[model samples]
Target chain A: MSLSLENVSAGYAGRPVLSGLDLAEVPSGSIVALVGANGAGKSTLLRGIAGLGEAKGRIVLDGQDISELPPEMLVGRIGYLPQALPQGSSLIAYEAVMSAVRAARPDSPRAGGAAAIEQVFDTLGLRDLAMRRLRELSGGQRQMVGLAQVLVRKPRLLLLDEPTSALDLRWQLTVLETVRRMADAEGAICVIAIHDINLALRFCDRLVVLGGGGVLSSGPPATALDADVLRRAYGIEARVEACSRGFAIVLADHALSLDHHSP
Target chain B: MTRHLTALQERSASLADLYGGFIRNRLIAIGLLAVGLACSLVLDVATGPSGLPVADILTGLLDRDALPRGQAVILWNIRLPYAVMAVLVGAALGLAGAEMQTVLNNPLASPFTLGVSAAATLGAALAMALEPDVPGLDETWLIPLSAFACAMAATLLIQTLAGRFGAGTDTVVLFGIAMLFAMNALLWLVQYVASTDALQQMVFWTMGSLARATWEKVAVVALVLAACVPLSMRSVWAMTALRGGDDHARSFGIPVERLRLRVLLRVSLLSAAAVAFVGTIGFIGLVGPHIARLTLGEDHRFYLPGSALAGALLLSLASIASKNLVPGLILPVGIVTSLVGIPLFMALILTQGRRP
Candidate 1:
């Protein structure tokens, strides 16, 4: 039982952003990184998987062919943290997390039960600030709260869009580490759309690089993080340094000069 | 060291316990609503043109054979329908207001902002002015039906304008304000065309009165309100998702446009029905939802029902107070609502500040 996309094509308003994309199998209990530049259709792919957008392909989960299911039923098995965390004026931190869990199970006993709620708060490290209003929190704190909300249900399939965009350095590391731990411990399939290439190389088991509305490359970081792939996708001439642990992409001076000269 | 660590853990556990206790204590709010309902019913029956004892009122309601004919007629035919209409109209307005707030994601949004009451008033005035000279026109049913139709038309117009302008809250509210002015002008034109008697009647009706309440009228209004409230409440989960903003709602698998349209239709039905019967009662829709939010927090499940109950109690109490304020004369219910609700809302604003 795993997640797979077969020859998927999707976009908005008849304009195709992702065409003929195929992923045979995404292993359960693994962190898969989706790396792309600004307009590389990474967000669109995640949206299609989450059933937020229309796609002309089959998305099979546990071999049940869930491509045609309504979003409410799909939500039971999948948890999604969108790219933006909306700021609600009146909702407090604890209430926001509770709402997400309630979305999955409107009448679930786990939502307001003392034991379940306490466990969520303790795991998220939100015990001290549980009573604080959402308007009072900083952007990074709000992002963490948003992430914790989707984790409340511990869904089988987790999709995150730019989860660490608003986080500070420490919180970024903490959040990525938590995502890794969640996938490993719970046997859940996790797909994260991340802009930080180094974090992707460090944490993800495999990388899917998208460029210009299609898949540029997909493989282990050691194989996919080559200079030619970076140059084509990011418009940058880069040097790939292979190390004992892994590899890193260092942008050359000419790439930096070209970036500065671009309109 | 172990004792100190245990003490710290105990304090954290106690704080979580307190948070749980506070939310579970929602029963207190339900109790308060029950008490308010009972008090309003007693006062509504007791304080009228003819004063009756509480025992006699209860006996009249229970055992129809036990009361005098005059008291029974006054209690059953007059005050009972009036009280019932007050409860229904108040509940509809409050529910609609809360739904609007949630749908628009703005605390200030209400049915009145969409010109619903204004359009209904204009429609009623037109019926009164234009149908008098025609052969055998019954104003009672014609006026309310016209009001309902016109209010629905106004709602559709506002929705169409919103769609054209990208369906944002600011555009919808702006269109509503424009429609209010347009309806007000039509109402003024109707007044200019009316005969002396017709004009006076229109003016009085516009001011609002529960004295015109009848059992049949209350039944129709009650049926419309009852149908709309549950349909609107069913959208509470969607409304909560929408409160997270449009993109968030979309990501959560909600069709943003469909949800907005559903809420708009429900609120329009509720507002049109209430305004058709009550003649544009103000402030209850605006103030009722605010009070509910302050007392019950912002969960629409609790907030919508709480607002309905609180609005019913507030308006019924206002009607009772209006009757008693002058010994022999009665003020229009709308006047009383404004006079009582404005100062109370002002006080609330001062105390709470502008907190969404």
Candidate 2:
């Protein structure tokens, strides 16, 4: 399976935030990081692909045109986790994930609902919290449950918008590791819109840096995110170094002089 | 290690029990509500002004020729239709209230409480004042017919505006309030222009009563509620999604606007049929859903039906109270419901606060 975006122009309401943007073909068994500044349209790109916002262009997933497909047809094939989670929902974690699964396939019986739900709980290490209501959980737990809702759908194309923004460091790595394993094992295409460039460079198989409204650079992270590209994507003077672990790391020195340069 | 394994087994056993217990509790609560509503209906019919015995009423209903003319009229025409209408209209308001709250994502969003019933009353008042000289329109039917039509018009108007611009829970609430004020002013204008007899009739309509529950009116309201409940049930999953929030619900492919619009139509049908029949009876619609939430939790499948049953029980009980409270002088059922619904509402709040 593969996913690609071509000539994708989209925005909220009528104003175009991203225009004529083209992304490289993202194949299965790979996790892609969409790294961009706050207003660089990373979330918009994902929402556009998910048909959440007004978008004009082609989003081909596994050789099928997603934008042309009806919403019911696209569901269960593509799942999106928005950045914000609803607060004070009294739904238990197990029920919340089950609702998402049923939303994906409304009329089918869950053959083994209890075991399947328990499997998801164990996979996410949420066994203890499974019975806890959403309102009772902490922010990080809520974020994990939000991700679990998306994963339980078993969608082929997963679009996660800052899913770990509220998570702690341990849970953040755990979530990213679980998502990476899901992609590799299921041959699913996963696109994560992340703010941390270092996390992106470390875990992502491929990185697509965004700026203004178009793709700035995209390739293997070590080559894609040089100091100059870092300065362009984010207004920060940074250094990319290969650590002893045989992967690249970004070390930010200071904020770049916006007076002379444009990010 | 042996103890730990037993602990795991116990945990799994409890988890399995959770679902069984949840289902059982909801079913049992609904059953109890049904039984209570039945009792209230029977007691209400038996305790009317003429004091017909329960056995006599049943015998009269079973065989009209077995009883005298006055008893037959009281059982079939007056008390029987009145009690049955209470259940039907109560269920309508209850179901309407539950669906409206879920779709709008606000606990306080009910047609009766939000001035929809008042708007319908204003419509009925207009119908009375104009007494439209159209052929084929009976004098007795004009008020309710106009009330149902105008209630639907107000609902569509509010829903259309909310769909276009002010679609959020808060915005829709404000729109409902604005609508309430406009309808009340229109009603006052009708009163100012009407003669003495018309004004007195309008005042009584505002108070609300089941004295006008004819077989035809009850049938119309019952049919409307029957149709509306199933239609609302068809979208039960989508409504559950909505309780989390519109954007969250939309992420799962639930069309938020379309779902809201559909539920709004069902709400309009149920509430219009109800308030048109018995003037502005607001408390049951508001309190019924709250009772349902307290007893059945928030799953729309159980909550919707539970609310209908609760509403039926509340209104029927209120009917009985309206009869026995003042003895010979039966206060308006609307007044009795408020007098009863408020204390019950406070009790629910106190109990819920103790839970979490």
Q: What digit string (tens of lDDT, one per residue) describes model 1 on residues B155-234?
A: 99887877776566777777888999999998888899789988998888888788778888889878887788778667
lDDT of each: 0.78, 0.82
Top lDDT: which candidate number? 2
Candidate 2 lDDT tens digits, A139-235: 8898888888788777788899998898888888998989989988999888999988778888898999988788889999879988888788888
* Highest-DockQ candidate: 2
In candidate 1, how many Å is residue A216 off? 4.3
Top-TM-score structure, candidate number: 2
Docking class of 1: acceptable
> For each candidate, what's the DockQ?
0.26, 0.43
lDDT of 1 by residue, A1-263 (tens): 38888888878767888988887688888788899778788888888888776677888898878866666677767878887666655566666666666644556546545566666667766676666666667777777877777777677898899999998788788878888888888888889999988888888888899886678889877787787778777777777775566555444434545653231
